[model samples]
Target: ILAALSFFATGSTQTNLGDNFVLGLSQAMTSRSIKEVTDSMTEHLASRHIRFPNTANEINRIKEGFFLKHRIRGVVGCIDCTHVPILAPAEADEDHPPIVYYNRKGYYSLNVQLVNLLVNMKILAANSQSPSSVHDSAIWAASIIRTNVERTFRKGNNIWLMGALLHICRNAQPGTPEARYTLRHSQTRNVIEKCNGLLKMRFRCLSKQLLYHPIRVGKIIYAAVVLHNLAIDFNLNDLNDEEPLIIDNDENVPNIHNNHDVLNEGSRVRANFIRRYF
Candidate 1:
């Protein structure tokens, strides 16, 4: 079963599994069987491996690490979205325009958000099933992790999430506290970019366009993340040895108007951080 999963998670097909050496031992296993085995393994291991920090100590460790290493006070994790390309699903209406899966990049994809621990590259949580058309800030606003962070972390134990800005204000003077803070935050939070790169590079399936059902493709993503976490936890250097891939953010993209209250709160929090720490 492990072999079956590794083969598929490595971006190889079930047909390749059947044609390769392992299953050919007694009799060539059918592609259907190979798929079944891998699917089962992915689900079981994902349940066991992927997890969020539950206790206060665990959460504190993450916060402390971010503050000490990244120099980002109040940050527990860095959040960002990446597109996983996929073929448009069948059984769709041909007459209507494709709006659900079509992203701004002119392709069908799933916008997967990953939240990784800054101290360690371990993936603490992820939301991988969102349609590609959704905006990154939209995904963050809807995340369950956002609610949990609010509920658990109190006023004194403030935990802020870091993400790239879609647009920067032209009025802010260069080398000002606000501008400097933004620059430092972007540089420190870039570890998530490395985390995403290592995951895709290690599991070639993520780097290639997936030719599977969107639902199943989500599972593959989760499974790949689980494997990436395990590799990091186990001190495996092979996956991390590769240089980080250059990920492009939506620079110069105009910000969408959102709830006034939410925007005010975010601005206030950032202002407090700059005043207190930056």
Candidate 2:
């Protein structure tokens, strides 16, 4: 720490504290054993007095509280995916499935999907810790809070729950109030995309091809999230003055016949298998 800081103080860029700190944070957080770093991070967070939701109950409350008051169109939250690059041990394929094609490393990953609802442009709920292979839509369907949203929509007839994702996104069953709502409100709900960009940009380690052991990679990913949540808690990196861009989207996308469509269409027998499986 002293070495890096001294170099920075001397205005030396080749081997400065800023570079060392970035390397240290990445190596310690993302590429080291999480069990070791989480303890230190926990202690650090304790000193800072920063708190993040550690359970599903707290997450649910945040969601309910946000939507209960906001009267925004077809939007409850913004949904998107981010990849945490992980190590690819040659032996991993023996236990794991085939290759994950979409990752930066094209080796392995813990695909984290973050869903956040912003109230007054502040993050309300931030969901994380999903497997790399999980689908964006499936995460929404499996969300504990979303089931309640569906039930509420069903009772109030406030909007129809003809299908799941559309209702959550506020896209209606074609020409419905919810459909118009989804298109109109999607502009306000795009904060997650921006958040992803800022996070990747701020932490260049995440933007790079991760070269670390798998176990260490998991810890690094969690540590980054914990640090991010802490920043949000303290308003450290919060950007409220910047006016967010809003787009006008009127086009509606169609949902499948049922929840099984992603798997069924890829193969002839697989399609039949999905019909029976669902």
Candidate 3:
């Protein structure tokens, strides 16, 4: 609702919808929890004769998924780092120091690099909390994709390269056993990148310093994502195609029983969101 209002309320570029929405949302939050505030805002927008998505669930799916085509399952949105300045941390703790960051924080202002994935553009898998120094490859390596699989297998601590099916396959030579296996496993993961681009374009607040507290900055991000859903739900834009790059079939990928039915704790697969997350 804030996004919708911001875009329509002003003709001037001084107040970006992404930034203003966050400001308004943070103010609204002064009287309510995030969820409560959002519910109230939905009602308020309706009363003001402006329409917004009726629910957060709908907002996440229809608005962001269809409108923006942010196709990472359980991801709400994706964003890479844009630079920032920050006051240095007051401690010598190595974990908190600015190593890879630019010398602005004396220390450094860390940008949270993430792709907020959505499963069927509904359920949000929160962004991974990692340091700014972490690159995309590193982030993907540390992702729940690997961790969850390891946990399921009751594996140990080391990151096994052979287990990185996608990477191993991409590096393999043609017609060889392991090469054939690696080539088969490699997946084209680009939809999420496109989502990142759209997000930066739509939410300018994320591209620059918010000049607000870190908490407020976070609100700014959330508000933009919420508003993104609103625009998509309203048909301001259309969904993009999200298909993984499929190399030659290796026949080594996990095979599960087709005879039995499985669900995500919900008792259904396709019904989980009615759309496949690429």
Best by TM-score: 1
Candidates 1 and 2: which is better by lDDT? 1
For residue 48, give model 2's deviation from the true position in Å: 11
- Cα distance off (Å), candidate 1, residue 273: 2.4
Off by over 4 Å in 3: 1-109, 113-123, 128-170, 175-187, 238-278
Per-candidate alpha-carbon RMSD to the true structure:
3.7, 9.7, 13.5
**lDDT by residue for model 3 over 1-278, one digit each (tens)?**
44433432222133343245555544334323433444554435323322223344544454345335422233223323332333344356465553654333343444444333322221122232333454444555556644543453354321111111223323445666544333322321343334444554555445444343334344445444555555655656433447332221112122222323321322242223222322
- Overall lDDT per candidate, in order of appearance: 0.69, 0.44, 0.37
Model 3: residue 191 alpha-carbon error in angstroms: 2.0
Q: How good is model 2 by TM-score? A: 0.52
Q: How do all the candidates rank in terms of TM-score, highest first?
A: 1, 2, 3
Candidate 2 off by > 4 Å: 1-35, 42-70, 73-77, 97-108, 120-131, 140-164, 167-179, 237-278
Question: Among all windows of ten consecutive residues in candidate 3, which has the lowest summed lDDT?
Answer: 157-166
Evaluation by TM-score, superior candidate among 2 and 3: 2
Q: TM-score: which is higher, 1 or 2?
A: 1
The TM-scores of all predictions, comma-separated, are 0.83, 0.52, 0.39
Pairs in clash, predicted candidate 1: none
Pairs that clash in candidate 2:
4-17, 29-220, 30-220, 74-181, 111-132, 172-178, 172-179
At residue 12, give the lDDT of candidate 2: 32
lDDT of 1 by residue, 39-123 (tens): 7656677767767776777778877888788776767777777888887877565532347788777888888888877677778
